[model samples]
Target: MTSHHNAPAEGGTEELSRSLTNRHIQLIAIGGAIGTGLFMGSGKTISVAGPSVILVYMIIGFMLYFVMRAMGELLLSRSGYRNFADFAGDILGPWAAFFTGWTYWFCWIVTGVADVIVIASVYIKFWLPTIPLWIPALVVIALLIVLNLPSVKGFGETEFWFAMIKIVAIVALIVIGLILIFTGFTHNYANGTATASFMNLFTTGGGFFGGEFMGFVMGFQIAVFAFVGIELVGTAAAETKNPEHNLPKAVNAIPIRILLFYVGSLVILMSVVPWQNFSKDESPFVMLFSLAGLGAAAHIVNLVVLTSALSSANSGIYSTSRMVYALATDGDAPRPFAKLTGRKVPRNALFLSGVFLLSSIVLMVFGLDKSTGFSIVTTISSLCFMFVWTIILISYLVYRKRRPMDHETSKFKMPGGLFMPYLVMAFFAFLLWAFTRDPDTLAGLIATPIWFALVGIGYLVLRRNPAHQAARAAHLAKVADEQANARAWQDQQLNASR
Candidate 1:
């Protein structure tokens, strides 16, 4: 059996420190679960899907819970695994690691770009009506880069406070909503009127399906976007302190959070204002606050949404840099990206990600309307994220089949095992189908394959390069030796204990 000393470093000698604690992990998970999608996109969903949007959120959360569990189990199966990409390579091949790592990097970069642009637009329109869009966009990019340049703990702390703001806001909404409901409050709008009552959900609008089956389908699409960052907790597993304990706590709490933050808020929003009164272009949170007689409701909601965008962009920068660092270490990307700073931060990889994030400025320069540009970018980002999710499930299936013994021994095994992965994949397939139903989403669907094709071609080209061939061979040897050593140690412990 190979010794741990024989196991080569997968990324490099410099490793990401386990600085994130249970508190940090918990808040990061919550922060990821809540994003601008819920703050800004929920209005469109309510307008489109009526009261039934609640079910869409719940269903998406349910499926993604299993996906997160799969990821948690995979990360725990091996200590050397940095992220899903590492395990994908170990179980699948070098190509799987390359594709998954780069695709995840691409996913967050696209998401970051979209987020900064949205933040800029929000600032210009709401507070500084005279500023150019590109100015604020550039400033936000710089701010996020500086914030992430320190350490993983800094990122964790920033996300913690950012997430706290959102949590408080949602909880406040729920509390106020319950108060209004109990006091028999009523709100009248131009399109429709509603009262603070449970019966308002079905009786006022088109009922559960939201007047048309197509609306429900469209709700599924938007709701999928809202949950885009839910798997971020898995990404943080390697950097987490005591991941075995913290990871499960974060994953288990998802259902309760989804019910309260998402489903509860929607139910109250519809009860107070009715689905018909919601506007596609406005935020339901703002509208609900206004209905409750808050004069500064729009401004307050804008600030919350603005912070939400910044938090998401911050997460994008962090995730993308780490992913690129993983790719470079594995010889899938340029060697320079594998370099780390004295603070243990992936500076080179972070710089590269920040460079891509600056594309948002170029997007702003194009002068596309805020709503139109946002829709296009988010659709593409959502598509890329779906691809990442599919890879995780595929990797999980491969793990279960090839490592049955590992599965049997795993303390944090996925609940449904094979059935859950397949079931989740089917749900993803349905979401993809739903995408094809809308023209905007269909455009995104058409554009997504082009990226995969490019990555595939790049992989083929890299395979022919002598340098990459050597690096891949060395990495695989290290992985094999490491696994052997791990097994040897496990057997030794078992024998000694007996």
Candidate 2:
């Protein structure tokens, strides 16, 4: 209900409220990283690797853990880190900052659009199961826009509840499944399709081609995608009350999360229902409950996914607005984006990002269903994030060469160090290969070049803006005046001494 349309015609940095607590940061990291994709998409990975899909999650989680470790090392190393983009610029170059800023902005925009589609579909699952997905998708988009248009605290609170719902759902499912595994609870499908009592989860289709080793390896890419948003914790640095203390706690919780959320729920799911029966199109969690004769589980799970979608969208808006703000402050984007309203929120930037978020509504007009529309936008999953990962890796490499002693002495150093980065980079490259293999995501990868090209052209175009030129001149002039004033003050003191 609060309007952001009153932003000043004058543009500059906005001092936003830093009310976010450690609880918010931890939950935001957990919730942002583990999205609907992990809950639903993991089902597909289950079929590929059977029980071994658990390894896929752990492996990718480990690799990313180190990546976050590297980021944390640099971020906490100096208080000067405003955001990751600034760090990239400081270590790499101004161009690195510009590209990272805008690419990250696009990444979140595309991601939020995908989440919007999922939220709409989740709504339709109830009243109008047969109704087109686009109608509900639009409604969900409108609702999140309303949420995001408010102050930062409003978004944080909404995400707090949203994440709590998902946590409860996963916990409940894990508890119920564990009981069945222990007490041998019988279900309708328990006798017919049940592959094995416990080991069926890892039966490995047969031998080499069986769903064990290679299958688990094959699922790594998707599993990695599921954890794509984990680093979102870093993005909240500007809003966090005390980023240093809170960030370490949030990052340290990743291993425990892997154990409980990813491994724990997954093991229970495999135990309750055989991995082979997993339906790629629908969430395996919903299927497990339906098979167990629980009518309410489908609706409950749907609500959880919808909540996840909202969280992802909220994060997307929050992150994209910041990235756009960074770009403008660095002169990579229009100065208008850096402008803020009285609330200290980037209102204009939020509006601009919201327009990109609404692009999903147009996807509906293309005669595509929400899933397909969602699919198109979701293609940025690997490309944009991988680019970020690449930049981070490159930045880390630069950090080591530039400051070897710092690398040797840092407490939060990545385990493998120089050797590990090469491995992580190789892993990232393989994931890209995995992305290329999928037809649904291929177009997004192809389109990445065009987007980068636009950024290149835009950077050059913005270089010539008259207002921008004037702003640059004014900044340089101010710097000169400060220098002249310092000289005159020193001379006046010398004259008094004489």
In TM-score terms, which candidate is top?
A: 1
lDDT scores of the candidates, listed in order: 0.82, 0.72
Stretches of model 2 off by over 4 angstroms after superposition: 1-14, 130-135, 187-196, 204-209, 212-214, 370-376, 404-412, 463-498
What is candidate 2's lDDT per residue for 95-194, written digit by digit as tens? Answer: 6777888888888887887777656555455657788766777677667668866777777788888889889988888877877777676544533645
Query: TM-scores of all models?
Result: 0.93, 0.86
lDDT of 1 at 130: 86
Candidate 1 residue-wise lDDT, 107-189, digit = tens: 88988888887788774469999898888888888899899999999999999999999998899898888889899997666
Error of 1 at 350 (Å): 0.7
Error of 1 at 92 (Å): 1.0
Mind sharing the TM-score for model 2? Answer: 0.86
